[model samples]
Target: MEKTKPMVAVVDDDPRLLESLEELLESAGYAACCFGSARGLLNHGLSHLDLLITDIGMPGMNGFELRDQVKKVRPELPVFLITGRHEIADQGRAQGISGFFRKPFDAPALLIAISEACKNRDGG
Candidate 1:
């Protein structure tokens, strides 16, 4: 039987970034769901998502807030944070995320991290 692709949700306020991430995720062979805001993601529900990658700085909800809400509902879900601000990375705010990436991160590395995260999720 063929294996199903993991469904990953990518949330960001920037339309360009969302499109870039969607292309990257698609090229990596995963199913990508793009959301313009945290509220938009919430509207879709989290039950079907295998992973979540969200921007740390958004217009309203923000990534940390979104991560907190998601964890409250689904603690086991793997959520990764991406930030354009270097200060945000220095603040040590990434508490319960599967991984954190700064802006202009290596796409290959992100793909490897996603693969590893999924493998670990399945193994445990």
Candidate 2:
């Protein structure tokens, strides 16, 4: 039987970044859902994702709040956060995130993080 395609939700306020992530994920053989804001993501795509890769900076509901909310709905789902700020990494780590990728994150590192997050989500 064919395997199911992995579903990753990529949320960011930056259109360029979101687009790049979608392309990257698609090239990596994952189906990526892109959203411009946390509210949009929550309203539309939260429950459908196998993994989440979100940017820390957003207009209204920031990534932290969004992550917490997503966790509430599905605690076992893996969330990989991306941020340019290093200071908040500790806080995110403390919250039980699978991985935190620094902005301008290398493709391999990001891909590995995604693969790891998928493994963790699948309990493998």
Candidate 3:
């Protein structure tokens, strides 16, 4: 039987960016779930989110803090953080995050990161 495709949850305060990422993830063959707020995401989020794509500098809950919280609950889940701000993105790099996307990220790069995260979760 074929393996089920990975599912990704993308949370971003910016509606336009969130939509763009949803399209990007879907086009790459992974399922994409989107949320506009961190609180909403943490509450009714997908339990089996194979990957999480978030912005690092959200107004309420920043990605680093959000990622840390999620890791405490689900460390195995992959978290890819996006940031248009160089400082924030660079800081997240050292946080053992799954991937990093500067604003205007390339589709292939994001997809590759998702693939790697899935592989890691699968013990590859």
Candidate 4:
């Protein structure tokens, strides 16, 4: 049987970042789902996601809030936090996350981490 691609959901207010991340995740063999807001992602539901990558600074629900909401249901899903703000990164709010990356983060490193997370999830 053929294996399915891992579905990775990304939430960010910036359209450019969403587009870039979607492209990057697709290029790296993940099935990407991009949301402009945390509400959008939450509305879509988390049952199908293999992983999540969200930006810290958003209009309404920030990444941390979104992560907390996700954990309430899909606690085992790997979450990666990304942000352009150095202060938020320094605040040490990245608890219970699989990984954290600053904006303009290295794509190769992100891909490797995603690969590892997906592999681990599949028990491979």
Candidate 5:
């Protein structure tokens, strides 16, 4: 039987960022789902995702709120938070995340972390 690629969900308000992350995830061999808002992601559901990467500053339901919500429903799912603002990261709201990346984050590093998180999730 063939193994399926891990599905990664990303929520970011910026369309460019969403497109970029989706392409990056796909090029790295994982399935990527992009959502423009946390509500959009929630509406679509979360059970199918292997991992989640969300931006900290969105219009409604920011990354921290979304992370809290995900923990409530799918606590085991690995979540990575990304943000362009340094102040948010400095405020220390990024606790309990699998990883945190600042915008302009190194793609290779992100991919490596994602790979490891997915592998660990599957007990591989």
Candidate 6:
């Protein structure tokens, strides 16, 4: 039997960042779903997602807010926050999220973190 690729929903307001992350995720062997806003992801639904990666500095709904809303429905879901603004990293960790990565983060390290997050969820 073939294994299914993990579905990762990535939300970022920056169009370029969104596209770049999607490509990176796909290259890393995960199914990537890109969203321009938290609302866009919410509207599309999260039934198929194994993980969520969001940006903290979005214009409307920020990553932290999105994580809260997502947790309300899917408590076990793993949410990772990525931001160009490094200060928000502490806040993201305070919320007890799966992980946080700064902009220009090492893609390989991010992939490792993602794998760990998924593994922990499965084990639990």
TM-score of each: 0.92, 0.89, 0.88, 0.92, 0.93, 0.91
Q: Tell me how candidate 3 scores on lDDT.
A: 0.83
Give stretches of model 4 more than 4 Å off.
Answer: 90-98
lDDT tens digits, residues 4-87, model 6? 999999999889988888899999899999999999999999889999999988989988899999999999899988988777
Least accurate 10 contiguous residues by lDDT in model 2:
89-98
Instruction: Give the higher-TM-score candidate: 2 or 5.
Output: 5
Error of 3 at 51 (Å): 0.7
lDDT of 4 by residue, 28-51 (tens): 888999999999999999999999
lDDT of 5 by residue, 33-105 (tens): 9999999999999989999999989998999999999999999999998999876665554554348788888
Judged by lDDT relative to the true structure, which candidate is superior, 1 or 4?
Answer: 4
- RMSD value for candidate 1: 2.0
In candidate 6, which residue pairs get closer than 3 Å at backbone N, Cα or C atoms, i.e. clash? Answer: none
Candidate 1 least-lDDT 10 residues: 89-98
**TM-score, predicted candidate 3 vs. hidden true structure:** 0.88
RMSD after CA superposition, every candidate: 2.0, 2.0, 1.9, 1.8, 1.8, 1.9
Clash pairs, model 3 backbone: none
Q: What is the lDDT of residue 36 in candidate 1?
A: 99
Lowest summed lDDT window (length 10), candidate 6? 89-98
Q: All models: lDDT?
A: 0.90, 0.85, 0.83, 0.90, 0.91, 0.89
Q: How does residue 18 of candidate 4 score in lDDT? A: 94
Residue 47 Cα positional deviation in candidate 6, in Å, after optimal superposition: 0.9
User: Which regions of candidate 2 deviate over 4 angstroms?
Assistant: 90-98
lDDT of 5 at 107: 97
